[model samples]
Target chain A: MRRAKFKAAAVAFIASATLASATLASAPAQAEIASGAVLANTCFSCHGTDGKSAGDMPTIAGKSEDFITRKLKAFKSGELEATIMNRIAKGFTDEEIAALAKFFSRR
Target chain B: MTELTRRGFNKGLGATTALGALSLSGIAPATAAGKAQVVVVGGGFGGATAAKYIKRFDPKIGVTLVEPSKRFVTCPFSNTVIGGLNTIDYITHGYDALKGLGVEVVHDSAAAVDGAKKQVRLAGGGSIGFDRCIVAPGVDFRWEAIEGLDAGTAARIPHAWKAGAQTLLLRKQLEAMADGGVFVISPPVNPFRCPPGPGERISLVASYFKTAKPRSKIIVLDPKEKFSKEGLFKEGWAALYPGMIEYRNLAEDGLVRRVDPASRTLYTDFGEETGDVVNFIPAQKAGKIAQVSGLADKTEWCPIHPRSFESTLQPGVHVIGDASIAAPMPKSAFTASTQAKVCAEAVVNLLRGAAPGAPKFINVCYSLVGENYGISVAMVYGYRDGRIVKIEGSGGLSPSGATPEFRRKEADYTRGWYESISRDIWG
Candidate 1:
């Protein structure tokens, strides 16, 4: 029952994110999506289809922009330690990093 | 193709078996004229974070990351893998992220450091000079602590404690055990990576086998009598994976004295404990590279100015993650990642001839106690009077005696955090 709810909620989140992105909120951060998508390619590999893991992966599909940005900044900046994430995140551009936060938060 | 080029260069240099402190000797004598050369060792948390930041913070600061492997697998959340929550491939990553960021990625082993001369001897018979350096080499196993255990034995009975293939290796072995097989976990002594990691791991592993291999059971032997999140784990184990888990504290000889893989048995000081599959997370210290760099003092870890994370024995270098003696924080990935950021800011300030003062550190570790039931501990800290001290308003543990609802929420938060943190570090 609990797992079912989680799956439903996750599906709802992805659907909402997809729906919402089409309207294209012109938040300055959202504008950097193309570049952020490129940088996010490294992440999308483990994080899975559009930051939504098949329930096994974490959902970066919809989070606060700065929150995602700060964390990536943390990894890139070394404020956090995740073996793969830290190594991979550290290689992003300042603009790319910002764009990633924006991309995932909006997704 | 870069791997082939590197192989050609090393063989051309007639290098045989690269060993010593990890270094970068491929630096081409600073022909770039006035650019600052920054060489980072270790491709794990600290080194990778520093290399990327140096390039972005000052792209002119030529950053060369000298690591033995082109790809690195993380140890954080690897418990999920050990527990069958995920796989190593999903958790593994490569240097393409860093390379894309315009950081020079050098796939070489650091042989030795000439800190005074600001140079690193490469494993491939060359010397790479640097203006400053960062060493985040993870850790190494202390093979001789147990009576009959060493690196060789670990291959037979993995300490999958460090993630990567070792984690999967142990998991595969566990999953293949007989229905009623005894799966034993030997937790390491104090000052090891991710203190809460083992208990979280055992619980998650037990969850998988409960349905798949109902008759299987687990036995945990530890060097310490008590542990962090003790109540929560015991409570969850009893209610969830009951009769499938047992714990023995080693103050009463809980330490495994010897092991014979052929016999599939482990002998603790208290008595003999045998299992179809055994997981041993042995005593640990900074990996060989950090040790060779003369960075680690007593405790076999680096001593650094908590505020800056700069090595006490060496200037122009900083150490973070499990290799450094960072108290007021557990040796977890979050702490390392946090320490990495603090170190990054400080290193940037130092490079720019600015000031690095009283930097704050934060850590929050979440462990999945059972399916969708997670617990955590969090704290915020600052370097005070030459020590890292926790800030009052910042952190706390998962609420005790909370609703199942609360626990489940923590699971969601943990996942969200992983997403948040992954994007922070890699995105």
Candidate 2:
């Protein structure tokens, strides 16, 4: 009985999402907003969820967007001393850095 | 039968609802609403993180994580457990936190995946359907590759590869041995789980022997010529446990053709060596489910789309972690969790009929040369023209000439990483 309901729900969701995507596909701006959320998620592995640190790693959440962008750029440029951040910072583009910074700063 | 594409899906959206009627032929619970379902197989670093991130990305999507084990013992710090610096409990995690996150946790092994039918047949019986599926079964040992080593005989030799009981067994074996006894550690060939694992294990076990059993020695029969953090590990061994560790690379006749578990002996190409305790990590491939489900190809690993980790062979199915052929990105807890997030986001996007976003992945692996000594290798990966490649000038090993204090700080950070990553994924 439970299995049948799950199947029904899954089909409905795909149907709704299909209709929803018609709208999302037309709007490039909405794609960016969603993209930013996922790009910043990669950081949670080390930096903690939503950029909050649970241990010795520094808390990236609650920081200013400008602070994040500047620090990341410095790390990328090798202007800042880092253990692992320098390598990670180099992987992101200026735009991605901005998105990540914006994502974390809001938290 | 009708085909479905993003461009033409709108026309067939009506057929999707009619398909729901086809599903009503079977029994289904009333609570299952019109939420898209994602079934995640295996609850290790990959599956757990994928489940969490999928919900994080879209709470409306229903997620059911299928794992056989109730508790997850991380491979990351299992070396510390063997070294006596930590206990198994420190590295062990429960699924309660994941359960608290509104994920439907199913304690069952996945028996088969019917991709065309969009259903996962469980070993416990019954089937769960999914709009998308994520398989993160980690790695299973290739017992046939090594003579005298199979699941039944593993207890005597103890791979300790999967942690939990095996970890305790290996630790107990080491503890039972006398001070002057020899410990033999043999690492399998390339593309095994956790590239830095054996190196770290050798270092930690040496650290253990250095204190409690000063006369004890370690013999490493490595199949590969070199390993991750090779320079750092070699330097640390020379400085800390000089003359206590002997490393024999493949070219030096370190290949073990067979194991004599009854005698605790390893038969290498040159000669057979007996030890008080033997740790043999056998050659590995994607977990059994991957092969049975048709996710793995001739390589015995799943090939995935570079951008989304979706299986190239099976659409709507994403394979991540040790099960996938993601070279340049070594199989570690960090990479598994990182891949999980990328896959989760991709799955969410696909379910929503939106294209997956451009992905960025990072991997940081820290190995303890001793209790207060640590070294790390890190990389930030990006999608290139057709594959995942290391971002140039982005990541590398720790400085070879670092001061003791720097090493100690890195060791501290190792603990911090374990805590934060655990919280992020299962917390």
Candidate 3:
């Protein structure tokens, strides 16, 4: 039992140490996606996490970046006939919409 | 369980190995300089989502979630359970997925938080230390605010606010009530959880009464002059159950003063009234732990930094959900979960010695006028001048008069919202 405990503790320590180092190395890459992730995160509450819809709401994940950008802009400009998307689209800036489009496209 | 196992293992190991492991793992005695430790209190929409997102944001961070229940019954869509439109099992969620994300799920309630020591004292006896704490302890009723209404008396008169046994109790009460009987709901004043909750409850109960007991009537004694989606609800009420529901405003003596649960009587300023079934939602404040820990101010809500949601009173602690004084953001599940994601990112950035990004929030509340008929109000918010303010001309209520098809579509989206949000938070 004592040997097992020692082994387990050692494994946990090594695992955590490796994870800490991995996080440090990936910091810059994570920052690149951070803004898009933050903006696209809100849409996950109704749209599923990562822009995949679990229900009637259309899934935005895996769509083309151009498709998303165009649809959101159309919704924002009131050219797209929608129920609630038009209202939500009106809140985002062009930059934010682009970030969201990029984030979901890459999902 | 991970922490507990580590603690037990450390006790049996030699001093050198234990010390080496502790330093390497960054477990306990101090923040130690390696992995970040975050202790989240409460496991509802706010804390659970924060816990999950924090790990998602940075898997290296150690997250310990403290909650009392093994499974959580959600407040949203709970009205459907009372109205017999859905089952309790459908609305309840488990924390297994959060555990699967490598979060330490501690099934213990938090008794108090020691801000100075940076530790949370648990009711189960041991204390858990943290680099930062996220408190999402929703709301608790001011039991003293109403006479003859305490936790014990609340058993007879169900508030059903927290959505568990009380939900089932209210449903059974409605089932037991005779035909043509009066169903009374007394909604409290502003800044309460789910401002539109009372209206939705009234609408759903009326839906049940309209079908099960057609002659049964509902009496809504609202303290507020006007309510959320008032015109939509009024229009729907007229179209569906006209004259079946009567609403009394504050000027008409709608505020409830005291309740006699034994007799099912409520005493308003005007006179006394009795109901076969009574749901007296009393005045509320921050959750019990937040109130007792000096996190809430005189207004009974925690003040927070609009950008990071860090409690103004407690520097290293973040407060989210209904307990937070996030005006222009009504207390709803969507807002709480969204706030959780924002607070999670902020906590991660703060730990990494980086500034939190600016955040924008969205809330779309859909209430069922009937199972097929729904009305909604949506708002988008941005941080401005030390407050969360709604963007101008961005959000408004659903069109006043709509086709039946529109209402039905909104209702469909309501179910979709619940499923998607539930998955996002706990799935």
TM-score of each: 0.74, 0.89, 0.89
DockQ of 2: 0.25
- Worst lDDT run of 10 residues, candidate 1 chain B, spans B13-22
| Chain B TM-score against the true chain B, each candidate | 0.89, 0.92, 0.92
Using DockQ as the measure, the top candidate is 2
DockQ for each model: 0.03, 0.25, 0.22
Model 1, B1-427: lDDT tens digits are 1223322322321121111112333332232236777788877766776676666555667788898876677777777787788877767778877887878888999887667678888898897877667888778888777767788887778998776778888888977888888888888888888888888988988987887788888888888888878888888888788788988886666778888876768897658887889888888998787788898897888887675677878766778888888887788777776676566655554443333422445466778887688887766564445577765544556656778877787776667666555545554
Error of 3 at A35 (Å): 1.1
The residue-by-residue lDDT of candidate 2 on A1-107, one tens digit each, is 97587456544433332333344343211232255676777788778899898887889998998899899999999999877778778877776677677779999
- On the 0 to 100 scale, the lDDT of residue B149 in model 1 is 77
TM-score of chain A of each: 0.60, 0.70, 0.70
Cα lDDT tens digits, model 1, A12-106, are 43333222322322211111113233334334423543576534346688889778878877876667854334534544444445556767887
Q: TM-score of the candidate numbered 1?
A: 0.74
Write the residue-wise lDDT of candidate 3 on B1-427 in tens digits: 1323232222222232224324543453222367889999999999999999999998889999999999999999999999999999999999999999999999999999866577899999999988789999999998898998998877899999889999999999999999999999998888889888888999999999999999999988887888888999999999999999999989888888889999999998988789999999988899999988889999999998766788878767889999999988999888998999989987776565444555689999989989999888898887655568887767788898899999999999999999899998899
Error of 2 at B79 (Å): 0.6
Residue B66 Cα positional deviation in candidate 1, in Å, after optimal superposition: 1.7
**Best first by DockQ, ranked:** 2, 3, 1
